[model samples]
Target: MFQTEYEFTLPMGYIDADGNLHRDGVMRLATGADEIVPLKDPRVQSNPAYLIVILLSRVVIRLGALEMINPKVIESLFAADLAYLQDLYNRINGNGTRSLKLVCPHCQQGIEVELDQPGES
Candidate 1:
């Protein structure tokens, strides 16, 4: 069976009004409508960057103990967390390999590391 949902951990995490920290979350593959609908949003129209917030809100099904995820929630994310989500969104939705290229500092050798989404052993 094909997998559409992916789990991830934020580098910094989100802190709620109650002082709760949310790090782990799940994001599903984005549909065409997810991409298209955000474009029509007035906020996205005013600020193109706001598109990611809307798009992410649509795809992120869960975040820690939060019962709901919305644009305001996404907007409240730290910059690092938002960037992490953006990369995750591109990686899964783009159908690209979940591998990252790196160069070993000690050996000065190139290597590729396969990234496993959270919840995987």
Candidate 2:
């Protein structure tokens, strides 16, 4: 059976204050309130983009040796890692396991693309 939570390795790991590199982690599928409740946060209201930062912090249950998963950790992550997680957040929550329907730009051929893997959009 499939699991609601998924494990992933960052393309570029998060380096903590102690200099330990954390590449392995797990994130759960976002619930409706997970996305909605953040809108009321002052941080989100002050800066719209901060939504993703907060959202990720909430869903990422574990990351390496870090006991506290907060926005600072998410913000400190490499751009590639952030992209990787965002793609994952959208994929699992957006369409489950089904491939997204699309058409080739050059060939104009219809295609089905699966964005199941981390960092794949």
Say which candidate scores most in lDDT: 1
Query: Candidate 2: where is the Cα deviation over 4 Å?
Result: 95-121
TM-score of each: 0.84, 0.79
Predictions: Cα RMSD each: 3.7, 5.2
lDDT of 2 by residue, 45-104 (tens): 999999999999999999988998999999999999999999888777764465779999
Q: Show model 1 residue runs off by greater than 4 Å.
A: 95-99, 104-106, 112-121
Give Cα distance to truth, residue 94, candidate 2, Å. Answer: 1.5
The residue pairs that clash in candidate 1, if any, are none
Clashing pairs in 2: none
For candidate 1, write residues 46-119 as lDDT tens digits. 99989999999999999999999999999999999999999889888865567899999999999999976534
Error of 2 at 59 (Å): 0.5
